[model samples]
Target: MTRPIAGWLSDMDGVLVHENQALPGAAEFIRALRDHGRPFLILTNNSIYTPRDLRARLSATGLDVPEDAIWTSALATAQFLTDQEPGGSAYVIGEAGLTTALDEAGYTLTAAEPDFVVLGETRTYSFEAITQAIRLIQGGARFIATNPDVTGPSADGDLPATGAVAAMITAATRREPYFVGKPNPMMIRSALNRIDAHSETTVMVGDRMDTDVVSGIEAGLRTFLVLTGSTRREDIARFPFRPSEIVDSIADLVDRVGTPA
Candidate 1:
């Protein structure tokens, strides 16, 4: 028998859960991974919630993911900053997730001659905060954003995300922010490092082609696309790239667990 894949990575939304609802078979897929002792992480571009908070949110959706099994853009950004300049300071424009990650990485949060004006996802964006970020970036602070998602789905409708705000700041300062999330491939690489997973033996499952599939391919992992979220099967032909496998939902993947792609 062929050996099972050594590691797995999945996007949090669409692949596993939609909003507060668990996608069908998400729990089963996670259970299968756990049963086979596969090292895995649920990746997310959202940078507002801590891993513990995300664990609780997932649990509410009927999925039992451990805190250590969650990786967010906030964590990736923090790791990147630590590697670039250990113990540096930043003027942050995010919530607890970003702040906590930066703190744990030994970065002091400050607005006084900060190294970077770090931006992330948040429910509310104050004009004062944006103004400060603009001034900081224009004053020689490097601009860095957690993700480039322009819009996010909300209960009411679509809402402006980090990318939109980043654009505003860019327009004012004429300095573009370095996006550290998916589509850049750095996020995927950092996640693999977090789990000590080899790209050759790791499989990435995500619902979006632009962010998830492209990033996974760039990172040299086997990519699987599901039709439970952002991208539909019809949209597949539009993209220049493609996923290694396509399934209707996470349910179909449950039986394929422990089987090498």
Candidate 2:
């Protein structure tokens, strides 16, 4: 028999909403979690927006996830740094999300002899910033990235994300960055810790097999792959691991929000 799921961690983009639009059954799923009084968190690998900013964006899409109920790569990265090097300084190359997280975590942002060179998502990737990051990493600063996602979804198309830039920096400095987001399992563990939930009684819902499913498995959580996102049915066979459950979308699991698997 399967254990009853007491907590939930779900991805934001492919699982809930896509490109300013809410996917099918998304609203109902959120409501069901609320109705059951479940501890739930919406997770995203994008480190481009703060949790408050993400909440507002989801609100516009008709999903009413709270700011506290949302977790991002930015937060995970900051938390990881806090654990690794408390009160350490960093040189950042991202937008408000990454910078704000580091700042709130009591990290001083600087360009001179920083402890780490942090990379994240930005609408615009400046050549000057990358150059500085390359030089900083070469100068003995450790390289750290929010996530390993190479590309992000845009209405226009896929855009180069943190991983691509990390690769560039690695090539220039010969130092690979330690990723702190999905697929790393550290991010999953951090999210579980945040909710005070045991991985044995929690489920991870996501649209991607590589990041979401893999991380959930590594973190000892049941995994659910929703087809409403970036992954397709055929894509499953390509991965060495598999999700515990596969659903058409968030709607299919609405009734099982607080029930046994």
Candidate 3:
């Protein structure tokens, strides 16, 4: 028989912290996981910041996760492209984080006749850039997107995410880009491989049913939905996907697992 999960794969934004604030019980729950020696990894779709940068930001908010324990779509995208073509070139329509990741992975960043067109979140997503990406894709370049999140949580409220930009490119090119973040099995597989964990022995925790819950289910892991960000109680009924469990916040997770201290 399968045992209760000995590890967890958690979403960063909505499940643990919302914006700059750590959600209720997030810190204590993390402490519990540490005390119990249960392995957990932070899997995030946000590609705007590096894992090290995100670790510092979360630490500043009192959610002490290690730099190496964090995995972002940016990193996964880099790994995927690197593995696909060891010394490939890419035309990136994204921010510093994505560019840095691709650069570190030995990908040449260019705008002309690249091997692939990479889409991620950018503060300055100009029409000119979109046109450029479309031209490249139409000219037979492969397309890859960091994540498929339509909106991102910000202090100013929800803003269009990288997926929105990807949609535009998809519309123009008539070809769907390969997604590398949540709701895609590639990310889960990468995380599991990194941690040396199995799907049956792992749990996925997040806020969104469509992304987090579905991803977990597809990966054959237990899924927990927290009502802290992106997803609300009312939205649960409308979501086509379902989680194995639903809690008010990460704090409630501690109460449920009661992992030995």
Cα error of candidate 2 at position 181, Å: 0.8
Tell me the lDDT of model 3 at 242.
80
**In candidate 3, how many clashes are counted?**
0
Error of 1 at 236 (Å): 0.6
Give stretches of model 1 more than 4 Å off.
1-4
Off by over 4 Å in 3: 255-261
lDDT of 1 by residue, 89-204 (tens): 99999999999999999999999999999999999999999999999998999999999999988899999999999999999999999999998899999999999999888889
Output the better candidate (1/3) by TM-score.
1
Candidate 2 lDDT, tens digit per residue, 1-261?
A: 678899999998889998799998999999999988999999998898999999999999999998899999999999999999999999999999999999999999999899999999998999999999999999899999999989887789899999998999999989999999999999999999999999999999999998999999999999999999889999899988999999999999999985756
Give the Cα error of residue 109 in candidate 3, in Å.
1.5
Residue 118 lDDT (model 2): 96
1-261, model 3: which lDDT tens digit per residue?
Answer: 656778888998888887688988989888877777777799888788888889889998898888878988898899999889998999998887798999999999998789999999866788998999999999999999999988876678878888888888888889899999988978887888778898888988998888888988998888889988778888999977788888888887885445421
Candidate 1 backbone clash number: 0
lDDT, candidate 1, equals: 0.94
Residue pairs in collision within model 3: none
List the global CA lDDT of all models: 0.94, 0.94, 0.86
